[model samples]
Target: MFFSQLINLKEDDSSMQFIIITHDAEIFDDSSVENIYKFESAPDGTIVSRL
Candidate 1:
């Protein structure tokens, strides 16, 4: 509910931007998301991926 509200608020206000960090990808199932960054941990360090 809160998550959806955030999206709605962002849509209503063009100047608004939300930064969400979530483990579930279902929230990003919509076409509204322009960019997605995934993080993975390795033995050496952390790796970042753009999907």
Candidate 2:
């Protein structure tokens, strides 16, 4: 599985990190995801909200 592969890669290098952007709400269901954020653009400027 993709998550399992990611786990292996992280174990091989403890300092590794990743920036994965996806529309799938399933990603948020994973416990390993330490942080979550939403990004959007508006007439004023770009806005980011931490979920």
**TM-score, prediction 2:** 0.65
Off by over 4 Å in 2: 10-13
- Minimum summed lDDT over a 10-residue window in model 2 is located at 9-18
Residue 15 Cα positional deviation in candidate 2, in Å, after optimal superposition: 2.3
Candidate 1 residue pairs in backbone clash: none
In order of appearance, the predictions have TM-scores of 0.60, 0.65
Instruction: Give the TM-score comparing model 1 with the true structure, all chains together.
Output: 0.60
lDDT of 1 by residue, 1-51 (tens): 665676675635555556778898788886477788898999999998998
lDDT of each: 0.75, 0.74
Instruction: Give the Å shift of residue 50 in candidate 1.
Output: 0.5
In the range 1-51, model 2's lDDT, one tens digit per residue, is 676786776645566566878777575685677788888889999898988
